[model samples]
Target: MPKGYEMLPNGIIRIKSDNSMYDPWEIKKSQLDGEELTLIGRVVWAEQKM
Candidate 1:
């Protein structure tokens, strides 16, 4: 885990390209095209915690 990233719970990731869905190929914290997506099931972080 990074300094500002946490694990996701029951989350689903989706890969996108040009603002479009890539396909059924989703993933976890990773880097694509030299970019660190830092995704946990497509979730960067918990935007809202209620």
Candidate 2:
């Protein structure tokens, strides 16, 4: 798992995209371990274009 990303108690991944304005994406825990999902890196800070 990358930085700032967390796994919930119910096996859900709580993650946010580079664009903070958009809603966070919740992925299943099993998906991360599968080939379907790839974790490259995480963005610590982002400046939204207004």
Candidate 3:
């Protein structure tokens, strides 16, 4: 998660997505527990590729 972001008790993490019409969506951290996900870097900014 980003700085100052809090993890929901339900384990749902909301992230911003410029590509999605939904914008913010819930993604349960529990769902990735078995996947062993890793954080490589933080995105400071982004631009749409068209």
lDDT of each: 0.42, 0.66, 0.57
The total number of steric clashes, by the backbone 3 Å criterion, in model 2 comes to 0
Better of 2 and 3 by TM-score: 2
Clashes per model (N, Cα, C within 3 A): 1, 0, 0
Which window of ten consecutive residues has the lowest lDDT sum in model 2?
34-43
Task: Estimate candidate 1's alpha-carbon lDDT, on a 0 to 1 scale.
Answer: 0.42
TM-score of model 3 (CA atoms): 0.39
What is the full ranking by TM-score, best candidate first? Answer: 2, 3, 1
1-50, model 1: which lDDT tens digit per residue?
22223345544345444323343355454434445554344435555678
Distance (Å) between predicted and true CA of 27, model 3? 0.6
Off by over 4 Å in 3: 1-6, 17-22, 34-50
By lDDT, the best candidate is 2
- lDDT of candidate 1 at residue 49, scale 0 to 100: 70
> lDDT per residue, candidate 3, 1-50, as tens digits?
24223367887776554444435556688888778544344676867989
Question: What are the root-mean-square deviations of the candidates from the true structure over C-alphas?
Answer: 11.7, 6.7, 7.1
**What is model 2's C-alpha RMSD?**
6.7
Please give, for residues 1-50, the per-residue lDDT of candidate 2 as tens digits.
23346778888887765555657778888866765545567566766989
Whichever of 1 and 2 has more TM-score, that candidate is 2
Best by TM-score: 2
